[model samples]
Target: MAESTAPPVRITSFGYGHCRGGLRIPRAHLVLDLRTHFRDPHVAPELRHMTARDQEVRDAVLSTPGISELVEATAAAVRAYQAGPTTELVTVAVGCTGGRHRAPTVALAVARALRLAHDWQAVTVIDRDIERSVIAR
Candidate 1:
């Protein structure tokens, strides 16, 4: 018998507030909020409709300054990891009030950015809540 080597799996999770505690994986993880990209006055009405609890979470994420820096950092981390000795898997989680709008949009943007900037062998966007219910259930 021979031991076979497998490429490292990068599991990236992009979800909403409901997914906070549920994300646990043995891979690089990045948690982000879609609301960070919107200026307070510019926050979409759809996003503003979040429950109080969810709004609090979004507020926290928005309070952080220089979010573009964070996104850039995430991309840089992925590039740096892929350049290292081991096969790499990068997981980025983008969250908003719900899985329907902002989270998915941000996830798609991040995925597109990664694909454009890095030659990652694989890139996946997981909407943990909806994905679990729709696909995993």
Candidate 2:
């Protein structure tokens, strides 16, 4: 594989509610608000405590009527970043009501797709509220 000059893509999952004062997205090129898209997993008794990493939560997020379309759109944008200026970083922030569930799920899905779709590009997913280690590949 050819050596990549493209900057690493940073994807963050955050809660819109967490931005009590304001949301800070470092080097964010695009922000996708998922607040209105998927049904809230927190409302369900089974999924309430689960992170987006759980199979059931991920399924709920992905199974929405038009959710797949958004995923495809997001992946397409990340691929486009590969062709853009290498010196510039691309960041896509996915935000929902609470970062714990929906946002992370969507971000992870996109990051995985981006990784497979563009193997040479570096992709990372982070949950801002949860403060877990960055998931990258």
Candidate 3:
């Protein structure tokens, strides 16, 4: 059978604090919360205003002890879902306190890992709250 070329998975990053009112978490096959397990870059004055798109913010988040392992594990889970009998889009939702830091950074990392592993030719990552105003904790 010829391999399908459509992207098989989507990853979204959100901030739990942004869910007030009508904003909602994206529905997904897997939802990983980093609010407790990972450190927040927003705590640092320098990183507070930056999004995951910034290299320094990316560096800080990726340097956290367990972030790399979590990214690999999430990719593995996506692989498991793809192995299922039905061919469907797999969605992964990653959430952190403000969504501008840890969550988006990790989501991008997971996409990178999956691509490096040749698990998928394309992976979509949406930074749901990366542009939103920083949440004051």
Write the residue-wise lDDT of candidate 1 on 1-137 in tens digits. 33323233343443344544755432345666554454431244554434222545345333446545665676676566556677545456655544544455445545666666644436666555433332111
Per-prediction TM-score to the true structure, in the order listed: 0.51, 0.83, 0.93
Ranking by lDDT: 3, 2, 1
TM-score of 3: 0.93
lDDT of 2 at 30: 81
> Per-residue lDDT of 13-83 in model 3, one digit per residue for the tens?
99999998999988999999999988888889998999999999999999999999999999999888877
Candidate 1 has which clashing residue pairs, if any?
Answer: 10-89, 12-91
Best by TM-score: 3
Would you give me the overall lDDT of model 2?
Answer: 0.77
Off by over 4 Å in 1: 1-16, 20-28, 34-69, 119-121, 130-137
User: Given candidate 3, what's the lDDT at residue 76?
Assistant: 91
The local distance difference test score of model 3 is 0.89
Clashing pairs in 2: none
| Each prediction's RMSD to truth | 9.3, 5.4, 2.1
lDDT of 3 at 112: 93
